[model samples]
Target chain A: EDQVTQSPEALRLQEGESSSLNCSYTVSGLRGLFWYRQDPGKGPEFLFTLYSAGEEKEKERLKATLTKKESFLHITAPKPEDSATYLCAVQAYHSGGGADGLTFGKGTHLIIQP
Target chain B: GAGVSQTPSNKVTEKGKYVELRCDPISGHTALYWYRQSLGQGPEFLIYFQGTGAADDSGLPNDRFFAVRPEGSVSTLKIQRTERGDSAVYLCASSLDSNNEQFFGPGTRLTVL
Candidate 1:
């Protein structure tokens, strides 16, 4: 069974404190892994996409790295504005038909205190 | 310049009523999708459309849920005889292509009473 699981469902970080979120997935064939930040009452905002193991991408204060079975999102010197639900999703290669939608994990709710 | 957009930011309706949620994708985006998100959960795929055709509808859950994208740019998700279980935040997203990163809309929060 293909599944995506994220650990540490919730996390609290003081301003300037750094942390990392974990996302592990099991799938027949890996296609792409994506990270998104979502705020309450709004939609998810795109963050990064990792295509292969050992690949990494960074934006602003966030960095995402991928391995064979898991991915990590590292937050550096976070601020209150950086507090949001971080979502991780995987798209399987050759998902039965030509169409494939992302399989998402529950997500990690991060709160940054000032 | 504009991102994806969904209409009726919040909808509250009684069970058994029919509802229509609309989505307008980004200009020139050929791939559009619909997803449902319950409270505290990630978005789940409902349907996918590519250039006016439904490439996949396997995730529609049941016959009561249907989506259409006639022109490939604007799409609508229709729910018939809705139930309280149908309550969720319906999200719409579009990508430059099928394998690209998708941009999401603000989403429509549906509350069935």
Candidate 2:
């Protein structure tokens, strides 16, 4: 089975502080990796999609990088509004058995104190 | 344009009762998905529909769970003989195509006591 593991189950940071969250995965063949931010009782909001190793994407203070075995979400100078649970998911290259659903990690909860 | 939307934001029902959750996908999105999420966990895929046909239903836990997307616009998820273990937030998502990113709805929080 395809599996995804995220490190640092929870994190606390002060305003303007920087930190990085890790997501490791094992899939048969990688089609894409995705990052999403979710607030309490709400759906996950899309962040970035990294398709290959050495590729990086950024949005505001959030940056996402991909590697063969893992992905990293780097938060730079974060603010209180940035506090949310970050999720990582992977879609395999072939929809084996015709199941194209994504496999997601447990997610990392982030709290930013102003 | 509106994003994916789910009805009955919160549903509290007694055990063994049947419930139906609805999903309205974004305009022009042909691919739809259903997932269930428990507290402190990420969403787990339940099913996927392409247009009016269910391309994949492998994630459905059992035969008691069923979904339909008639006319290829709105979909409904039906659960029978609900058990306490079935309580969770049911999420609905949609993508432009199988290869696009899936955008999610707010989710329907279900509680079976």
Index of the highest-DockQ prediction:
1
The pairs that clash in candidate 1 are: none
List, residue by residue over A16-48, the lDDT tens digit for candidate 1.
999999999998777799999999999999999
Residue-pair clashes, model 1 = 0
Q: Which residue ranges in model 1 land beyond 4 Å of their true spot?
A: A95-99
Q: After TM-score superposition, what is the CA distance of residue B6 in candidate 1 from its true location, in Å?
A: 0.3
lDDT measured at residue B111 in model 1 versus the true structure, 0 to 100: 98
Tell me the deviation in Å of residue B84 in model 2. 0.6
lDDT of 2 by residue, B40-59 (tens): 99999899898999988989
Candidate 2 DockQ, CA atoms: 0.73
Q: TM-score per candidate, in order?
A: 0.97, 0.97
Worst 10 residues of 2 chain A by lDDT: A92-101
Against the hidden true structure, what lDDT does model 1 obtain? 0.93
